[model samples]
Target: MSRTVFCRKYQEELEGLERAPYPGPIGENIYETISKKAWQDWLSHQTMLINEKHLNMMDASSREYLKQEMQKFFAGEDYDKAEGYVPPVEKE
Candidate 1:
């Protein structure tokens, strides 16, 4: 059986990540508190933010902005969205 956690984002028990996404305390916190689904969602959103905002990952400010957004995202606070971007409709 897989591990389960009370995911911070979803606010309920769900499947947990097999390992921390990266080294350090924050990653360990995510492994303990964030669900796999939430992490995947963040990745997709992060990609959209990077592309739409033309963020340069090598820049410290850009990285810091993403880090702040990531915190807000998991905290269920108001987070920035890709301006004027629309989601594709799902097939029935």
Candidate 2:
């Protein structure tokens, strides 16, 4: 059976991740509080940010920026978006 957690982003209880996303306090904290759904959402959003900003994981600053943005994204705060990205138009 899968575990459940009080999802921080959705503000409700939900199915939790199978394991920590990474090693360390941050990963532990995420494992304890973040739901799988929210984590998936973050992954998609993170991809957008990385692609939009042309971030280089090799650069410490870029990684740090993504870390900060990840925090904001989970906290339901204002987070940066990809540059020059347009939402797909809905078809009627």
Candidate 3:
């Protein structure tokens, strides 16, 4: 059975990740508060960020920017997105 968490991004209780995505306190906090679905969404968003911005993972500042952006994204704050990106409309 999967675990559950009160997802900060979705603002609801949902299935949680099996393990921390990273190996630190921030990862611990995410495991305790973020749902698996939300984390997956972030992964896609992160990919877009990296690609659109040409962010180099080897750079300390790039990693720090991503960390801050991740925090903002999950916190329901205004976070940066790929320039000229238009979110696809969902069909109901």
Full-model lDDT for every candidate: 0.94, 0.93, 0.95
Give a tens-digit lDDT track for model 1, residues 1-92.
Answer: 99999999999999999999968998999999999999999999999999999999999999999999999999899999997998778999
Against the hidden true structure, what lDDT does model 2 obtain? 0.93
Residue-level lDDT of model 3, residues 36-91, one tens digit each, is 99999999999989988999999999999999999999999999988797767889
Q: What TM-score do all the candidates reach, one by one?
A: 0.93, 0.91, 0.91
Against the correct fold, how does model 2 do in TM-score? 0.91
TM-score-best of 1 and 2: 1
Measured with C-alpha atoms, the lDDT of residue 17 in candidate 3 is 96
Model 3 residue 8 CA deviation (Å) reads 0.8
lDDT of 2 by residue, 1-92 (tens): 88999999999999999999979999999999999999999998888888878889999999999999989999999999876798668899
- Model 3 sits at a Cα RMSD from the real structure of 2.4
RMSD, every candidate, angstroms: 1.2, 2.1, 2.4
Which pairs of residues clash in candidate 1, taking residues 3 or more apart in a chain or in different chains? none
Q: In model 1, where do residues sit more than 4 Å from their true spots?
A: 90-92
By lDDT, is 1 or 2 better?
1
Report the backbone clash tally of model 3: 0
Question: What range of 10 consecutive residues in model 1 has the weakest lDDT sum?
Answer: 81-90
- Model 3: colliding residue pairs: none
